[model samples]
Target: MRFLRAAAQALGGGLFLTLFVVFILQVTARFGFNKPLPWTDEAAVVLYVWVILWAAATIVPEREHVVFDLLWNMAPRRVRLGMRIVGNLVVGGLAAVAIPATWDYVHFMQRESTPVLGIPFMWVFLPFVFLMLALVARCAWAVYTALRGQGLEAELHLS
Candidate 1:
């Protein structure tokens, strides 16, 4: 499980770095050389999407996602646990429903190709489906751990 978290973080970070580098190169080429790379914009956009999705998945195990916890914090531990479980179930069900709908949307877009990259647009959009699925899994795991009294400590640190 730790390995999975680390791998997700690495994947997200690496993709984000790649996107930044490509974006900088594109900007330099456009302004400095007066010639822009045709595929750079499309590629950077695709990589950015991947980075955001993977970052969400990577951070989930750390309990870094935002939650309105004022009420939960004030509730008894048992109540909090129940709230967490119910929330996770609701989110998981939503994600499960959304995945197929998103896949259908992606399939609808499959015939369209990105202008510069010439790849099917679905390839770029499909990550949302996977991201949601990952989120559902993470939430379910959190509910499980919480039920077992093994909830992860909050990792939000104030600077």
Candidate 2:
């Protein structure tokens, strides 16, 4: 699991760095060289999608994403525990729902290719499917911790 986490972090970080470099290349080519590379924009877009999906999955286990927890923070310990479990379960259910839809959509694109790169369209959505699966696992862990009496505030580092 830790290996997977590390790989996801590296993958996301690398893609983001690639996107940044690609943007710089695009800008320099357009303004400095007066000749833009048409492929750079498409590459940046692809990198952006991969980076965001991996980042979202990485944040889920740590509960580090931006959150509105004012109400959850104010609840009693026992109530917060229940809320934590419920919240995790809800998110897990959402992930469950997303898995099949994502898979089907990806499968539906089997015959298609991306306009710019000519890569299989399904390849673009593989990261989305991976994120959804990771989220499901993270939510399950969150629910387990909550059931063991961990408060939402504490789990999310709000306490």
Candidate 3:
């Protein structure tokens, strides 16, 4: 589990760096050289998708995703646990639905190609599907941990 978390964080970090570099190159080429890299826009967009998705996967284990913790803290212990489980279940269901739907959309887009990148449009959408699936898995794991009486506060060192 620690290895997976480290891997996710490394992947997210690499994607973020790629995005930053691509964006900087794009800006530099367009304004400074009056010529933009043909693949820069598409590459940046794709990198952004990967970064956002992978970052979520990386952060989930760390309990960095946004939550209404104030309300959760005010609730009774049993209520809090129930709410956590229910919330995870709902998120998991949404992810399950999103994965197939997004994949279908990506499949449809596979028939088309991006202008500059010449890559299938599906390439952009596929990462989103993967991201949703990762989120689903992360949610399931969270619920499992909670049920085992291992709350995020205990597992994660927020400081």
Candidate 2 Cα misplacement greater than 4 A, ranges: 59-61, 154-159
Task: State candidate 2's TM-score.
Answer: 0.87
TM-scores, in order shown? Answer: 0.84, 0.87, 0.81
Order the candidates by TM-score, highest first: 2, 1, 3
In candidate 3, which residue ranges exceed 4 Å CA deviation? Answer: 59-62, 152-159
Show the lowest summed lDDT stretch of 10 residues, model 3.
150-159
What global local distance difference test value does model 2 have? 0.80
- Looking at model 2, the pairs that clash are none
- lDDT of all predictions: 0.79, 0.80, 0.77
Please, what are the lDDT tens digits per residue for candidate 2 over residues 75-155?
A: 878888888788889989998988998899988887898777887877766788878898898889888888876645533
Q: What is candidate 2's CA lDDT for residue 134? A: 82
- Between prediction 2 and prediction 3, which has the larger TM-score? 2
Q: What tens-digit string does per-residue lDDT give for candidate 1 at 1-159? A: 789778877877788889999999999999999999988988998898877776775555444666666676677777777877888888887888788888899888899988987888888777777787787787788788888977633333442
Instruction: Give the runs in model 1 whose Cα sits over 4 Å from its true position.
Output: 59-62, 152-159
Best by TM-score: 2
Clashes of 2: 0
Worst 10 residues of 1 by lDDT: 150-159
